[model samples]
Target: MNFLTIFARNLKQGPQTEAFPLGPAFTPERLRGRIEFNADHCEGCRICERVCPANAIRFAKTPDGMTFDCWHNTCVFCGNCEFYCPTDAIHQTNDWDLSHVNADKFDMVEHGLIPNQKCVECGATALNTAPVIKNAKPPLSAEEYTELRARCPKCRAKYLKNRKVPA
Candidate 1:
Protein backbone atom coordinates (compact mmCIF):
# COMPACT_ATOMS: atom_id res chain seq x y z
CA MET A 1 0.00 0.00 0.00
CA ASN A 2 2.83 2.48 0.91
CA PHE A 3 4.83 1.69 -2.26
CA LEU A 4 1.74 2.11 -4.53
CA THR A 5 0.93 5.60 -3.15
CA ILE A 6 4.53 6.85 -3.59
CA PHE A 7 4.79 5.45 -7.14
CA ALA A 8 1.47 7.05 -8.21
CA ARG A 9 2.46 10.43 -6.74
CA ASN A 10 5.77 10.45 -8.59
CA LEU A 11 4.09 9.61 -11.92
CA LYS A 12 1.61 12.48 -11.46
CA GLN A 13 4.40 15.06 -10.97
CA GLY A 14 4.36 15.86 -14.71
CA PRO A 15 1.70 18.04 -16.39
CA GLN A 16 -1.84 16.77 -16.72
CA THR A 17 -2.90 15.90 -20.27
CA GLU A 18 -5.88 17.92 -21.51
CA ALA A 19 -8.75 16.09 -23.18
CA PHE A 20 -8.98 16.86 -26.90
CA PRO A 21 -12.27 17.72 -28.72
CA LEU A 22 -13.77 18.54 -25.30
CA GLY A 23 -10.75 20.44 -23.92
CA PRO A 24 -8.97 21.94 -26.93
CA ALA A 25 -7.75 20.71 -30.30
CA PHE A 26 -3.98 20.96 -30.53
CA THR A 27 -3.11 22.88 -33.70
CA PRO A 28 -1.10 25.84 -34.89
CA GLU A 29 -1.55 28.86 -37.16
CA ARG A 30 0.87 27.33 -39.67
CA LEU A 31 -0.67 23.85 -39.53
CA ARG A 32 -1.10 22.57 -43.09
CA GLY A 33 -4.37 21.08 -44.31
CA ARG A 34 -5.87 21.43 -47.83
CA ILE A 35 -3.56 22.31 -50.68
CA GLU A 36 -4.27 25.52 -52.65
CA PHE A 37 -3.75 26.18 -56.32
CA ASN A 38 -3.68 29.03 -58.85
CA ALA A 39 -4.75 27.67 -62.26
CA ASP A 40 -3.21 30.51 -64.25
CA HIS A 41 0.05 30.34 -62.30
CA CYS A 42 0.50 26.58 -62.83
CA GLU A 43 2.74 25.94 -65.84
CA GLY A 44 1.78 22.23 -66.20
CA CYS A 45 5.18 21.25 -64.87
CA ARG A 46 5.32 17.84 -63.16
CA ILE A 47 7.99 18.79 -60.59
CA CYS A 48 5.36 18.60 -57.85
CA GLU A 49 4.30 15.10 -58.96
CA ARG A 50 7.86 13.71 -58.79
CA VAL A 51 8.37 14.88 -55.18
CA CYS A 52 5.04 14.06 -53.56
CA PRO A 53 5.41 11.42 -50.80
CA ALA A 54 1.77 10.35 -50.82
CA ASN A 55 1.39 10.45 -54.62
CA ALA A 56 -1.59 12.74 -54.02
CA ILE A 57 -0.97 15.31 -56.73
CA ARG A 58 -1.12 14.06 -60.32
CA PHE A 59 -1.55 15.32 -63.86
CA ALA A 60 -4.58 14.87 -66.08
CA LYS A 61 -3.11 14.77 -69.54
CA THR A 62 -4.94 15.64 -72.70
CA PRO A 63 -4.83 13.43 -75.83
CA ASP A 64 -1.75 15.37 -76.90
CA GLY A 65 -0.13 14.77 -73.46
CA MET A 66 -0.70 18.21 -71.97
CA THR A 67 -1.05 18.44 -68.19
CA PHE A 68 -3.85 20.44 -66.51
CA ASP A 69 -4.52 19.20 -63.02
CA CYS A 70 -3.84 19.96 -59.35
CA TRP A 71 -5.42 17.26 -57.21
CA HIS A 72 -5.83 18.16 -53.50
CA ASN A 73 -7.58 15.22 -51.80
CA THR A 74 -4.74 12.68 -52.10
CA CYS A 75 -2.17 15.30 -51.00
CA VAL A 76 -0.42 14.56 -47.68
CA PHE A 77 0.39 18.16 -46.66
CA CYS A 78 4.16 17.48 -46.43
CA GLY A 79 4.82 20.93 -48.01
CA ASN A 80 7.62 19.51 -50.16
CA CYS A 81 5.83 20.33 -53.44
CA GLU A 82 4.80 23.75 -52.17
CA PHE A 83 8.43 24.54 -51.25
CA TYR A 84 9.70 23.29 -54.61
CA CYS A 85 7.10 25.02 -56.81
CA PRO A 86 9.09 27.28 -59.18
CA THR A 87 6.02 29.07 -60.57
CA ASP A 88 4.46 29.64 -57.10
CA ALA A 89 1.26 28.00 -58.42
CA ILE A 90 0.65 25.72 -55.44
CA HIS A 91 0.49 26.49 -51.71
CA GLN A 92 -0.97 25.02 -48.50
CA THR A 93 -4.05 26.49 -46.84
CA ASN A 94 -5.46 26.02 -43.32
CA ASP A 95 -8.76 24.75 -44.74
CA TRP A 96 -9.77 21.32 -43.35
CA ASP A 97 -13.03 20.86 -45.25
CA LEU A 98 -11.92 17.67 -46.95
CA SER A 99 -14.70 15.55 -45.44
CA HIS A 100 -17.38 14.22 -47.77
CA VAL A 101 -20.36 11.91 -47.32
CA ASN A 102 -20.19 10.43 -50.82
CA ALA A 103 -17.23 8.26 -51.80
CA ASP A 104 -17.51 9.61 -55.35
CA LYS A 105 -16.58 13.09 -54.12
CA PHE A 106 -13.09 11.84 -53.25
CA ASP A 107 -12.52 10.72 -56.83
CA MET A 108 -10.84 14.02 -57.60
CA VAL A 109 -9.53 14.99 -61.01
CA GLU A 110 -6.06 16.48 -61.23
CA HIS A 111 -7.43 19.90 -62.06
CA GLY A 112 -10.96 18.88 -60.98
CA LEU A 113 -12.60 20.19 -64.12
CA ILE A 114 -15.56 19.25 -66.33
CA PRO A 115 -14.21 19.31 -69.85
CA ASN A 116 -15.79 19.74 -73.34
CA GLN A 117 -17.62 23.06 -73.31
CA LYS A 118 -17.85 25.76 -75.99
CA CYS A 119 -16.03 29.07 -75.70
CA VAL A 120 -18.67 31.80 -76.17
CA GLU A 121 -16.69 33.91 -78.63
CA CYS A 122 -14.84 31.16 -80.55
CA GLY A 123 -17.68 28.60 -80.49
CA ALA A 124 -15.22 25.72 -80.12
CA THR A 125 -14.70 23.02 -77.44
CA ALA A 126 -10.94 23.55 -77.37
CA LEU A 127 -11.16 26.38 -74.82
CA ASN A 128 -13.31 24.31 -72.41
CA THR A 129 -11.73 24.82 -68.98
CA ALA A 130 -12.47 25.68 -65.39
CA PRO A 131 -14.22 28.84 -64.17
CA VAL A 132 -15.19 30.33 -67.54
CA ILE A 133 -16.15 34.02 -67.52
CA LYS A 134 -18.67 35.24 -70.09
CA ASN A 135 -17.03 38.43 -71.44
CA ALA A 136 -20.31 39.69 -72.98
CA LYS A 137 -21.64 42.98 -71.57
CA PRO A 138 -24.25 42.71 -68.78
CA PRO A 139 -27.85 43.46 -69.82
CA LEU A 140 -28.56 47.19 -69.66
CA SER A 141 -30.96 48.39 -66.97
CA ALA A 142 -34.30 49.95 -68.14
CA GLU A 143 -33.42 53.30 -66.49
CA GLU A 144 -30.15 53.37 -68.49
CA TYR A 145 -32.16 53.52 -71.76
CA THR A 146 -34.25 56.50 -70.59
CA GLU A 147 -33.82 58.84 -73.57
CA LEU A 148 -35.95 60.56 -76.26
CA ARG A 149 -35.99 59.11 -79.81
CA ALA A 150 -32.94 56.88 -79.04
CA ARG A 151 -33.08 55.30 -82.55
CA CYS A 152 -34.90 55.52 -85.94
CA PRO A 153 -37.94 53.40 -86.87
CA LYS A 154 -35.79 50.46 -88.11
CA CYS A 155 -33.74 50.19 -84.86
CA ARG A 156 -36.82 50.76 -82.66
CA ALA A 157 -38.71 47.99 -84.49
CA LYS A 158 -35.87 45.51 -83.90
CA TYR A 159 -35.55 46.54 -80.22
CA LEU A 160 -39.33 46.27 -79.62
CA LYS A 161 -39.36 42.81 -81.20
CA ASN A 162 -36.66 41.63 -78.71
CA ARG A 163 -38.36 43.10 -75.59
CA LYS A 164 -39.54 40.44 -73.05
CA VAL A 165 -43.06 40.54 -71.54
CA PRO A 166 -43.56 40.56 -67.72
CA ALA A 167 -45.69 37.40 -67.94
Candidate 2:
Protein backbone atom coordinates (compact mmCIF):
# COMPACT_ATOMS: atom_id res chain seq x y z
CA MET A 1 0.00 0.00 0.00
CA ASN A 2 1.07 3.58 -0.53
CA PHE A 3 2.34 5.86 2.34
CA LEU A 4 -0.86 8.01 2.36
CA THR A 5 -3.15 4.92 2.50
CA ILE A 6 -1.07 3.33 5.32
CA PHE A 7 -0.99 6.62 7.22
CA ALA A 8 -4.78 7.03 6.99
CA ARG A 9 -5.34 3.41 8.15
CA ASN A 10 -2.96 3.89 11.11
CA LEU A 11 -4.69 7.13 12.07
CA LYS A 12 -8.09 5.37 12.06
CA GLN A 13 -6.74 2.68 14.48
CA GLY A 14 -5.34 4.93 17.23
CA PRO A 15 -3.42 3.85 20.38
CA GLN A 16 -2.89 0.18 19.47
CA THR A 17 -0.72 -0.54 22.48
CA GLU A 18 -2.09 -0.94 25.99
CA ALA A 19 -1.46 1.95 28.38
CA PHE A 20 0.87 0.54 31.03
CA PRO A 21 2.07 2.39 34.18
CA LEU A 22 -1.05 4.56 33.67
CA GLY A 23 -3.70 1.85 33.47
CA PRO A 24 -3.90 -1.84 34.46
CA ALA A 25 -1.02 -4.07 33.41
CA PHE A 26 -1.73 -7.31 31.65
CA THR A 27 0.32 -10.50 32.06
CA PRO A 28 -0.23 -13.76 30.23
CA GLU A 29 -1.70 -16.76 31.99
CA ARG A 30 0.79 -19.23 33.55
CA LEU A 31 3.44 -16.55 33.35
CA ARG A 32 6.37 -17.27 35.65
CA GLY A 33 7.22 -13.95 37.23
CA ARG A 34 8.42 -13.70 40.81
CA ILE A 35 9.16 -16.18 43.56
CA GLU A 36 6.72 -16.59 46.41
CA PHE A 37 7.91 -18.72 49.29
CA ASN A 38 5.65 -20.12 51.99
CA ALA A 39 7.73 -21.07 55.00
CA ASP A 40 4.92 -23.03 56.64
CA HIS A 41 4.63 -25.35 53.63
CA CYS A 42 8.40 -25.75 53.27
CA GLU A 43 10.18 -28.82 54.70
CA GLY A 44 13.76 -27.64 54.23
CA CYS A 45 14.14 -30.08 51.36
CA ARG A 46 16.69 -27.82 49.55
CA ILE A 47 15.49 -29.24 46.24
CA CYS A 48 14.65 -25.77 45.03
CA GLU A 49 18.16 -24.57 45.74
CA ARG A 50 19.68 -27.44 43.77
CA VAL A 51 17.39 -26.88 40.76
CA CYS A 52 17.68 -23.09 40.54
CA PRO A 53 19.46 -22.23 37.26
CA ALA A 54 20.19 -18.64 38.34
CA ASN A 55 21.64 -19.64 41.71
CA ALA A 56 19.20 -17.17 43.24
CA ILE A 57 18.17 -19.46 46.05
CA ARG A 58 20.51 -19.70 49.07
CA PHE A 59 20.06 -21.84 52.14
CA ALA A 60 21.56 -20.71 55.42
CA LYS A 61 21.66 -23.04 58.41
CA THR A 62 21.09 -21.29 61.70
CA PRO A 63 21.34 -22.57 65.25
CA ASP A 64 17.57 -22.68 65.60
CA GLY A 65 16.55 -23.26 62.00
CA MET A 66 17.43 -22.78 58.34
CA THR A 67 16.82 -19.72 56.15
CA PHE A 68 15.94 -19.68 52.44
CA ASP A 69 16.93 -16.54 50.59
CA CYS A 70 16.03 -15.67 46.98
CA TRP A 71 17.37 -12.68 45.11
CA HIS A 72 15.01 -11.36 42.45
CA ASN A 73 17.77 -9.57 40.58
CA THR A 74 19.59 -12.83 40.01
CA CYS A 75 16.44 -14.79 39.20
CA VAL A 76 15.82 -15.53 35.53
CA PHE A 77 12.07 -16.15 35.99
CA CYS A 78 12.58 -19.75 34.88
CA GLY A 79 10.32 -21.16 37.66
CA ASN A 80 12.75 -24.00 38.36
CA CYS A 81 12.50 -23.58 42.14
CA GLU A 82 8.71 -23.61 42.07
CA PHE A 83 8.70 -26.81 40.04
CA TYR A 84 11.36 -28.56 42.14
CA CYS A 85 9.77 -27.76 45.50
CA PRO A 86 8.06 -30.95 46.65
CA THR A 87 6.09 -29.23 49.41
CA ASP A 88 4.63 -26.59 47.05
CA ALA A 89 6.29 -23.98 49.24
CA ILE A 90 7.91 -22.08 46.42
CA HIS A 91 5.54 -20.60 43.82
CA GLN A 92 5.93 -18.33 40.80
CA THR A 93 3.40 -15.52 40.92
CA ASN A 94 2.33 -13.19 38.07
CA ASP A 95 3.68 -10.03 39.68
CA TRP A 96 6.66 -9.19 37.47
CA ASP A 97 7.17 -5.55 38.48
CA LEU A 98 10.50 -6.12 40.22
CA SER A 99 12.12 -2.72 39.64
CA HIS A 100 14.10 -1.42 42.62
CA VAL A 101 16.88 1.05 43.39
CA ASN A 102 18.48 -0.80 46.33
CA ALA A 103 19.08 -4.40 45.32
CA ASP A 104 18.84 -5.61 48.91
CA LYS A 105 15.13 -4.82 48.98
CA PHE A 106 14.50 -7.32 46.18
CA ASP A 107 16.03 -10.12 48.24
CA MET A 108 13.33 -12.31 49.75
CA VAL A 109 14.30 -14.44 52.72
CA GLU A 110 12.17 -17.05 54.48
CA HIS A 111 13.35 -18.56 57.74
CA GLY A 112 12.14 -21.90 58.93
CA LEU A 113 12.77 -23.31 62.40
CA ILE A 114 13.29 -27.06 62.24
CA PRO A 115 13.56 -28.84 65.58
CA ASN A 116 16.16 -31.59 65.53
CA GLN A 117 15.24 -34.87 67.10
CA LYS A 118 17.73 -35.91 69.75
CA CYS A 119 19.13 -39.41 69.71
CA VAL A 120 18.03 -41.52 72.65
CA GLU A 121 21.36 -43.31 72.95
CA CYS A 122 24.06 -40.68 72.31
CA GLY A 123 21.75 -37.61 72.61
CA ALA A 124 23.10 -36.41 69.27
CA THR A 125 20.93 -34.44 66.81
CA ALA A 126 19.27 -36.06 63.79
CA LEU A 127 19.65 -34.79 60.23
CA ASN A 128 16.02 -35.19 59.23
CA THR A 129 14.30 -31.91 58.30
CA ALA A 130 10.60 -30.93 58.29
CA PRO A 131 9.60 -33.13 55.33
CA VAL A 132 10.77 -36.29 57.07
CA ILE A 133 8.25 -35.79 59.85
CA LYS A 134 5.40 -34.38 57.74
CA ASN A 135 5.71 -36.89 54.92
CA ALA A 136 6.38 -39.92 57.07
CA LYS A 137 5.08 -43.12 55.52
CA PRO A 138 2.74 -45.42 57.42
CA PRO A 139 2.51 -49.25 57.80
CA LEU A 140 4.95 -48.67 60.66
CA SER A 141 4.01 -50.06 64.02
CA ALA A 142 3.71 -47.90 67.13
CA GLU A 143 7.21 -48.86 68.16
CA GLU A 144 8.56 -48.14 64.69
CA TYR A 145 6.80 -44.82 64.57
CA THR A 146 8.28 -43.80 67.90
CA GLU A 147 11.71 -44.98 66.81
CA LEU A 148 11.53 -42.94 63.61
CA ARG A 149 10.65 -39.78 65.52
CA ALA A 150 13.98 -37.91 65.99
CA ARG A 151 17.15 -39.96 66.48
CA CYS A 152 20.21 -39.20 64.38
CA PRO A 153 20.94 -41.48 61.39
CA LYS A 154 24.00 -43.03 63.06
CA CYS A 155 22.19 -43.68 66.35
CA ARG A 156 19.06 -44.83 64.56
CA ALA A 157 21.17 -47.33 62.63
CA LYS A 158 22.68 -48.66 65.83
CA TYR A 159 19.29 -48.78 67.52
CA LEU A 160 17.78 -50.65 64.62
CA LYS A 161 20.69 -53.08 64.57
CA ASN A 162 20.25 -53.94 68.27
CA ARG A 163 16.50 -54.41 67.86
CA LYS A 164 15.14 -57.85 67.10
CA VAL A 165 12.65 -56.41 64.54
CA PRO A 166 13.84 -55.49 61.06
CA ALA A 167 12.81 -52.05 59.73
Number of clashes recorded per candidate: 3, 0
> What does candidate 1's lDDT look like per residue over 17-64, in tens digits?
666656765667787977777665554456887899888776665654
Candidate 1 residue spans exceeding 4 A from truth: 1-27, 63-67, 107-167
Candidate 2 lDDT by residue in tens digits, 1-167: 59999899999998778879899888887888878888756667789889988888898776655767887778898988887777788889888787766756744543344454567767886544533433334345667746754567666556555656436
Clashing pairs in 1: 69-110, 69-111, 70-110
Cα displacement (angstroms), candidate 1, residue 10, comes to 26
User: In candidate 2, which residue pairs clash?
Assistant: none
Give the poorly placed runs of model 2, Cα more than 4 Å off.
Answer: 1-14, 103-129, 132-167
Q: In candidate 1, how many Å is residue 9 off? A: 25
